[model samples]
Target: MKILIVENEIYLAQSIASKLSHFGFVCEMIPSVGEAMQMEAADIILLSANIPGQDFYPLIEKFKDSIVILMIPYVNEEMVMRPLKAGISDYIVKPFMIDELICKIEHYTAFRQLQKEIAFYRDYFCNSLLMPTYSINTKISFPLIIKSVSQKVIDMCVVNYAIHKKLAINFISLYKNHHYKEIFKSVSKTQLTYIIGFETLRKEEKEECVKALKNIPVIFACLGGDLHDFKNVFEINVKEMTHGFQEDVLSVDEYIKTMILKFEDKYPDTELSKRLGMSRKSLWEKRKKYGITKKK
Candidate 1:
């Protein structure tokens, strides 16, 4: 990473640049805020608040996007608090060890990276699951089984559960690994295990797998049909709500029925029917056939 040292003390700037360069950091030194402002962009900015007659706030604002740390002679309103409010990431006392500064740089770099990743995944999840919202059952207990017609429904339920519980999900697909049982032994107790592709296992294998997970905190996503063998099974009916097209194949009639059920309330008959590629009469007939009640 590139480091910009904006300190008026020439000797101190050279010492810091030399120490940081030894640790694989590209260091640039400038003696004033004016010169530093004109310098090229850097990943991190170490601005000394003690620069004589220079208003360091302008430099702080200029490099607000970078990890700007104040090299303060003493901690007070002008040096630490005000710069922090103005977007300086942190401050280090003078005469500090090089290792301590490196530690702060590494720490904030990881933090900023995590912020970027969170932003990306949040947008990704929002786009992937565009319609339908899910809530965890109040009576939900760990080591549960979620039975749903659509894989997407089960996925939303598990994702919502993990988020609500503030736990990370350790996803495991049975089709991909026959020895998934071994994962349970080594899995972190803090993470929630979300298991899919259980239908690929044999009857005996399913039974053994269930026994092995008896004491582990896990949620099984069983696609289609009610699983009678397991207790604490939560069924999410696909008919109750719809999320448009899905990974699972549906008959033409079923698809039409799901579409009407999902959009009937949201759109008028003329718009809804046109979108479904059918006339208002056919929409009425399909609603009748599927026994779906249209809201007044």
Candidate 2:
């Protein structure tokens, strides 16, 4: 990382540069803010706040994106607070330990990196949810429950709804073993919360979850089953099929019944039986047992 040190004290600047160079930092020393501004870009700016005749605010504005650490002679609001409020990263009192200065630099560096990463991910998540095909019903209000056969469909709907409303979503998946009681206790009343895998909870647990989330602003997406007893919650059942296969694993009988019913019109009985790895007679017997009939 490149560091620009703006200090009139030549010896102090050289000492700082020499020590930082040992740690693999590219250091450039300038006597004034004017000279510092004339230099190339730097990852960090170590600006002396007590420069006799130089105005430091211009330098701060120039390197606003860079990590700016003030080197102040004394701790006072006049020398420190104004720059800090103007977006200076941090300040160190003069004659401080080199280790302490390095520690501060590392902390702010990591913090700036974290901020960038958070911004990138926030934009990515929002852009991913902004789909033109998915439509959100704005008439429906919050504290809603969505019932769907497919979890993917529910996810798409909720995400699209959040984007439509221009509200940020705090997503919690019950499948991840999150405690419902804790989730309820910590739920944000300001932001919109989306709770997925509601059907994964037991019937008694569902009742408890419903009770806990009663007053919270949440959108519950139940992958299967219905929360019929939950009062004052708006329920939406989406019947549309998403682009992928169902997430829920089906029993052999259920799988066979669904496949036969779906493909009976598309393919003949012989082909369908062959695809299912069964004889026509066995397929017929299975269909009769499952009470599934081919529509004429």
Candidate 3:
């Protein structure tokens, strides 16, 4: 990482640079804010609070996106808290150990990386959920159950609903999580409680869960079962790519059968067979064996 140390104290600045250089970090030292402003980019900025006549706020603003650590003589509002609002990531007190400073830098680095990754995934899920997979003309209200052959279908429906309503989801997988009552009790009023793996629950557990979810913005997913007790229960069977479960491993034959059944009319036999790594004759034979009739 590239570090820009802005300090008027020449000896201290050189010492910090020398120590950090041992750790494979590229370090640059600027004596004044005027000199620091001439530079374009850096991964981190270590700005000294005691730069007599120089205003360090401009330097902080320039590298606001980078990790800016304020090096202060003492902890006070003027040196620490006030600069934080102006985009200082953290403050390290003068006379601190080098190890402590390195720890702060590493912590902020990991935190910033996590923030970027979260942002990327949020954008990805948001865009992917907006895809028009299954359309329902009837206006479906919340606090319902979706019974589907695969969990993927239920997830799509729930995510689409949450996105449409501009509400966040407090998702809990009942198969993996047993302390669901606590989660349901703690869920925010603004968020929806989306629970999956209803098939894994016992009869009494189901009754208790249903009671707990009453009159709340909730969506329950029951995979490969009939859950008709709910008032707004939707049983959806997608024939094209319907598997018993989302994570079920399909055999070679089963995979071929599913592909042919789903895409036989979409592509010609030659192209489809080539895509599936088989000859047209072999594709026809497999279709016949699987009892899948092709459309005219």
Candidate 4:
């Protein structure tokens, strides 16, 4: 990462630059905010607020997006709070150890990385849900069960509901060897927990899961029939063949099979064949090849 040191004290700036450079950081030392502003960009900015007669607020505003750590002689409202409130990442008092400063830099860098990853996943999840048709009723109670033919559809509904309610979900799939009691104990009460793959669990395991999740705020996504024991059971039967945008190109056989299976009942064979750019006989042969027999 690139580090920009904005300090009028040349000796102090060089001292910090040399130590940081040893740790594999690219360092640039500027004697004034004017010089620092002239530089192209930096990952982190170490600004010395003790620079006499220099208004450092402008520097803070210029690099507001960068990790701006103020280096001040003393902590006060004007020196610390003002800059912090104006988006300064952090502040280190003068004569502090290089190790402490580096620790702060690493901490903020990791935090920024986490924020980016969270944003990316949130966007991807929301976009994936756009293709599915589902609804979350506001009156629906927690500790609920969602029984669906498609696990993907259930996932989309539950996740989108959590997102809408501004709740963070701790997802645990029973397909893995996850201890239900241990997971229940570890999950935060303030956050919602989603226990998935309940249909895959054995009768004893399901009983154990119910005991562990009793009276807790959880949403269970089970595949197959309705769960009678659960208080609030929401059934979602999504018949859409396409889950979302396909990342990979489907093979001709796969494409033909999917089209024939999804649209065969909705359209006559001639119309279906026309849509598929093939004759009715060809569609019938393709179906036979794929072992897809129409229901009588």
Candidate 5:
């Protein structure tokens, strides 16, 4: 983690840097908020209210919405409250224990991350039409095309979150519940399929979803997938994948989400059974062995 400290105090900055460095964190010490403003790439910035010439309020404006924690010599309603409202992520009083400082750092850093993620999804919802389903006539555009613009913006915003930020993140937790969820009452919700086209998922993470995709009987048929082939496969044994819960197969809106994780890394799904881990005849026998019945 690259931690930025914008404190004019020389010795205090060095001491804080040393403390943070002991824990394998890279610390960048800049005496003034002005200089710190120049290196805007810092992951976390610790600002001081008691700086020379400049107040910390405007720095909050300069780096608006950044995960900046303010450190002050003293704390009161007036000082702490104002910065908090002015977009300071969290505030710390000077002469505090190192442990407390670190704890506060961890707590607020997590909160800031969550806020950013929520903002990202909100932006996505705003840019994209959250229609339940896009209907198509003969030779109509793929539904995913309409959503491509919004998805790109959201993914771009969150692209450089961290090394592993590409891992699957539940979109439900990011967005608030809607008023009319049951509006899909008429639609037969089967297996959730992420029918997206624009994004790419690392094979590994995509495969991870496939592994977790068990118990729910999900499938990943791309737009180019043979609809009839998939249908034939489904007609043969719908119950095989469903594990008997075929009626309530759910979450297709997120089905293909893992695919959007990252494009640079090529990771294969490590957990899917090898060839379903059985020979064709063996699979047939096991269906009988398990006393499973095909529904379609």
Candidate 6:
């Protein structure tokens, strides 16, 4: 989280910035509102109303959307009311708690998340430049590290999910040591496929992966789907969702993240292992394996 502190008091700004940085916020100390206007972006802005001439007021006109924490010298009515009227997010009286300020940061971040989710639903998803796709219910309710023998399906699932969730996603399951060992045992024979364009890959670096796929077979089958017949591979009953724009493509990792994030949004309470139709521990294992950080 990027934080911008607009304070004329250098010592005070440094103190707050140092504290906020410890709490995982990236702090930028700006000596004045003029400096803040020069910022390209920041997650939160802490502004002080110490000097004269509508202190911090002008910047609010420019950055009303930026989450603003106002520090006013007087705890009186007018000082507080002015910023509130100008759409500040929160207020901190002079000589307040560093702990208290952190609490306010957490509070506002939560509120911002709620607003983000709302806006995401209302505007972002529907307007996404997404490939037409179908859903995957692996039965695991939570995210887990599951390696796919087939890269194409992995790619498809990601794009499908990213389109649904309005988030850029990438699937990094390709570099694993194992193929999610028992996941196929629980697939239950239902194939849920999706349409995707070929952002095809296979550089010399994939020589090892190609060698491994020789043992697994599905990786080759996924890419060629039996028509190429590089080896005597048989076409299985994996589901397919064909669409017109299937030529516009994304990479495999990108597709996978898209799938997972969308899945997360769809089943907010999803126990990825079970709800996603996988082994109970599979989802948890996947998250741990991928180091997929959970969003607060």
Which candidate has the top score in TM-score? 4
Model 3 ranges with Cα > 4 A deviation:
21-24, 125-296
What lDDT score is found at residue 34 in candidate 3?
96
lDDT of 6 by residue, 1-296 (tens): 88888888899989988887788888988887766777887778888888545356778777787788888887887878777999999899888888999999889889989998867754543444432333444432222212333444444455455555554433223224234322333222223222221112233323333343333312221332112313332232223334545343546554444444446544543565455566635655555554343444
Q: Residue 268 deviation, candidate 5, in Å?
A: 31
In order of appearance, the predictions have TM-scores of: 0.65, 0.57, 0.56, 0.72, 0.46, 0.43
Across 1-296, the per-residue lDDT of candidate 2 in tens digits comes to: 99999999999999999999998999999999888888768999999988898899988989999999999999988988899988899999998889999999999999999999868765654564323334555455446777655445556667667767788889876656446566775469888898876655666877877666665678887644446776544433332332343344456765676576557768898999999999999899976664443455
**Tens-digit lDDT track for model 4 on 65-139?**
789999999988998898999889999999999999999999999999999998987777777645335656547
Model 2 regions more than 4 Å off: 14-28, 31-35, 75-78, 81-87, 98-107, 114-118, 121-143, 147-171, 178-193, 223-296
Task: Give per-residue lDDT, candidate 2, residue 282.
Answer: 89
Candidate 4 overall lDDT versus native: 0.77
Name the better of 5 and 6 by TM-score: 5
Model 3 has an lDDT value of 0.76
Per-residue lDDT, model 4, residue 78, is 91
Which has the better lDDT: candidate 1, or candidate 5? Answer: 1
Q: How badly does each model clash, as a count of residue pairs?
A: 0, 0, 0, 0, 9, 35
Write the residue-wise lDDT of candidate 5 on 235-255 in tens digits.
112232233344322233232
TM-score, candidate 6, is 0.43
Q: Tens digits of per-residue lDDT for model 3 on 42-140?
A: 999999999999888988888889999999999887887789999999999997788998999899999999999868755755665333553333556
Q: Which ten residues in a row have the lowest lDDT in candidate 4?
A: 240-249
Cα-based RMSD of candidate 2:
9.9
Q: Tell me which of candidates 1 and 2 scores higher on lDDT.
A: 1
Instruction: Rate residue 241 of model 2 by lDDT.
Output: 31
